[model samples]
Target: MKYFLAFLIFSQTLLASDDWGQNGHRTVGETAENYLKSRVSKKIDRILNGQSIADASTYADEIKSDRAYDEYKPWHYANIPFDQTYAEAEKNPKGDIVFGIEECISKLKSNKLNKEQEQFYLKMLIHLVGDMHQPLHFGLKEDKGANDFKVKWFYNPTNLHSVWDTKMIESYNMSYTELSASLPELSKSEVQSIKSGTLLDWVEESRALTQEVYNSAEADENLSYRYMYDWFNVAQLQMKKAGIRLAVILNDIYS
Candidate 1:
């Protein structure tokens, strides 16, 4: 088995995406579900099945779990330069998105990978595809969304980024099955378009949205019930988007 690493931050109440300070992760899970259905296509099914199945059938489950905490990984923040350089940096080995994905792909390709390693790649890919859909994971510019800034999350004290990464996802109170069933379906064209962009473009898209989401909220704001209810709309949008984008990426990879 591969040595699986867990990075979840636990507390009294689970963090729901609706309570998140950022909405970049809104669409991940839903996007992935959409992608999986399309995999029934003979060409992609063969590719997915062709993978070294010396491992087993934990592939989809592993992918979902990997994406569970993807929003909070503290990567990509250290990547992406401030301006024109951001584009150039992606071409370099050290780029945050580049290095992370490369590491994942390398692990997938390594013959030494035990079943555990193969599984890790599957999960990590699922999570990373969602992360890549989140613009903040593309770059944080300065604060990394208040990882450095401390604030009270309603009654609880936490950082801005943590609120978005964990709290929001936990708040929905829906089991993954409930959440999955409630989400809207992605159209074929929608699937194609969301997955069409390069990873760099995904980052750039998120980076652009980040400015608006972050700037709209103030530091030290008290996020209570009312605030969460209002933002739930945003969270739903993000979740749906994630599902669509995830399907796009997975369908392409397995294709």
Candidate 2:
């Protein structure tokens, strides 16, 4: 039984194209729902067959275990070199988070997809919006989004991508609801400010932050309290911004 549980855990991590892990994705989805128009929220409920946005947010990641879903593996991230901007970065022909998000938006807005396709793309959009906010989603191809950039959390061996994706969030011991509520309370103007950007602008913002994330640790360094202190607020802010921007896109689509 113990080995079975361990295998289950390992299989999940291995299969998941995780960004911000499940909790962070759910927090972004839950926060967005708070700001959604009533009509939009009802529409989302119908589209999802009553699943909450928070539950829907992890659908893309959850699907990764299915071999049939293998094509979306690249949609989780966009790799670029440290010194180059996204424009100068070599594009992934398979698609990246930016492409995934844009494609989702375009499909949903066309008003032509069947109900099943609509549900699939909406879930993909929610997940990709959360993914693009995670700085490592724009990380260097050299380290596979820092998964090869090995580091230790406290004393346990892990990779840099795991640190941002789950370590800091899991260490904080918050439920998605708790995490969403703990995020800074924005005024109406602040919420609007977060939603102002186009997809290009948002993608660029996360790409720029990737440099700082790379700078934050050396290979095999032990990351603990100090690491969290330096980066937690930035993580929180990015999730919050993604939530608002997601709400803006959805309201525009279904309004």
Q: List runs of model 1 lying over 4 Å from the truth.
A: 1-31, 37-85, 89-95, 102-116, 139-142, 184-189
Pairs clashing within candidate 2 = none
Candidate-wise lDDT, in order: 0.51, 0.89
Give lDDT tens digits, candidate 2, residues 1-255. 999899877877655536898889999999999879999999999999999999999889888878999898898889988777777778889988878888999999999999999999999999999998999988888788899999999999999898999989999999999999999888888887788878888888888888899999999999999999999999999999989888988999999
Residue-level lDDT tens digits of model 1 in 101-128:
5566666556566665555665555455
Output the number of the lDDT-best candidate.
2
lDDT at residue 79 of model 2 (Cα atoms): 91
Worst 10 residues of 1 by lDDT: 52-61
